[model samples]
Target: MKVTAWNDGKKTYGIRVGIRNRDRFFNKSWRNIEVDIEGSIYQFKLTPGFWKHCPEFRDSVKPTIREWLEKYNLVGWPKRKPPRFELVQIDNNKFRLEKYKISL
Candidate 1:
C-alpha cells in the first residue's frame, strides 16, 4: 500500500491509499482516507476496509502523516499557546486523537 496526501485549499487535506498486486496489472484505485493535521497533532479515520488494505499503518499512521505534514510545512506551531490533546471515540472502532509535539 502506498499513501499520498494533498491539501484541498479549504483548511482540509486528503489522503489516498493505493495498492498493487505483484503482477503489476491488478492495481486498486486510490482510496480516500480521512486525515487532518493541526499543529503537531494528526488525526486519521480508518475504516475496516482501510485497515484490511493497510494494517501495517495502524500503529504508525499518525506519526507518518505528521511527518508528511511537517516535511511540507503544512502544520503550524504556536509558541504562545499550546493546543490541548483529546481522544474522542466516534464509535466502538472509530476515534480521533492528538499526538506529537510541534517545535517552535
Candidate 2:
C-alpha cells in the first residue's frame, strides 16, 4: 500500500503520524520509530494518542522517509483521477470503513 502527499507550502505538508494497533492499549514500540527529512534531522514515534495520528509529524528524531514508512502499517487508498485541490486539505483525511480505502 502507498500514499501520495502534496506539498502545501503552508505549515509542513504530507507528513502523517502512523496509527498504531488502535484496538490495543498503550504501545512502547513507538519509541523506536524514525523519520527522515531533507536536512537529515531525525524523529521517533510516540505512545498511542493524537501524536500517533499527527497530520504533521511531532517527533524529535528524523529518520529517512523509507525507514518511517517501513514501520507504518499502510492502509490502501485509491489514486485520484484528478486532484481537486492544490494541497490535500484534511489532516488525516478519512477512512472508508464500509469500503477498503484510506483517502489521503
Candidate 3:
C-alpha cells in the first residue's frame, strides 16, 4: 500500500490498499483490523461497501500513516515517493506492515 496526502494539502492522509491484495479479505463486510507498524498497534475498521472496490483505511487511519513514515524515516521525502510497505496477513483480522530498505 502507498501513503496518500490530501489534494488540498490539509495534512490529511491515508493508506490505500492495492487492488491486487483487496481480494484477500473476501468477506466484503466491515471488519476490525489491528495493524502492527514496527511495534505499535493501530486499530482500524475495514469499511464495507460494494462501491468501495479498493479497501482504504481513512479517517481514523491517519496515525498509521504518520507512524509508518516516522518509523521508516521518510518524513521529509518528496511527494508521492514513499516506498510501498509489505502487508503481511497474520490471520483473518491481524496484519503486519514493514518496509525493507535495500542496500546497494
Candidate 4:
C-alpha cells in the first residue's frame, strides 16, 4: 500500500490515508496500530471521522518516525507534493513501513 506524508500546518507530521483498499489490513473497530520501521516499532492511531481508515502516528512516537524519514531525505515539504512510501502487513496487527525507490 502507498502511504503519503502530511503536516497539520504546525509541528505535527503524519501519513495521509486515502481511499481504503478492498483487502483490509486493519480491523473495523479502529484499534491502535503498531508499525515497524527499520527496527523500531512506532505506535499509531486511527483519527476520528473520515480519517479513521488511516493510522496516524501518535505524538509520543512522532519525532522518531520524522527523524528517520528526514535522515534518509525521504520527506516532502508541506506545500509540495508529499513523499510516498510503501506499507506492508507482515502479520496480524503488525506491519512494516518502508521507503520506496524506483529503478530505471
* lDDT, model 3: 0.56
**Residue-wise lDDT of candidate 2 within 23-83, one digit each (tens)?**
2322344443332233343433443443434433332333343333333433222343211
* lDDT by residue for model 3 (17-73), tens: 655567655345547678787787787776664226645564363666765565556
**Order of models, best lDDT first:** 4, 3, 1, 2
Model 4: residue 36 alpha-carbon error in angstroms: 0.4
Say what the RMSD of model 4 is. 3.5
Runs of candidate 3 with Cα error greater than 4 angstroms are: 1-9, 48-54, 59-62, 76-80, 102-104
Cα displacement (Å) at residue 52, model 3: 1.4
Q: Give candidate 2 misplaced runs (Cα > 4 Å).
A: 1-14, 17-28, 39-41, 50-56, 59-104
Q: Model 2: clashing residue pairs? A: 35-62, 35-63, 36-63, 42-61, 42-62, 43-61, 43-62
Q: How many clashes would you count in candidate 1?
A: 0
Worst 10 residues of 3 by lDDT: 1-10
Candidate 4 error regions (>4 Å): 50-62, 74-80, 102-104
Instruction: Please list all clashing residue pairs in model 3, or write none if there are none.
Output: none
**Prediction RMSDs, each to the true structure:** 12.4, 12.1, 4.2, 3.5
**Cα lDDT tens digits for candidate 1, 1-104:** 23334333334433433343111322124322223334333434443454355421232343554455566564544433322233333343333444434333
Quantify all predictions' global Cα lDDT against the true fold: 0.37, 0.31, 0.56, 0.63
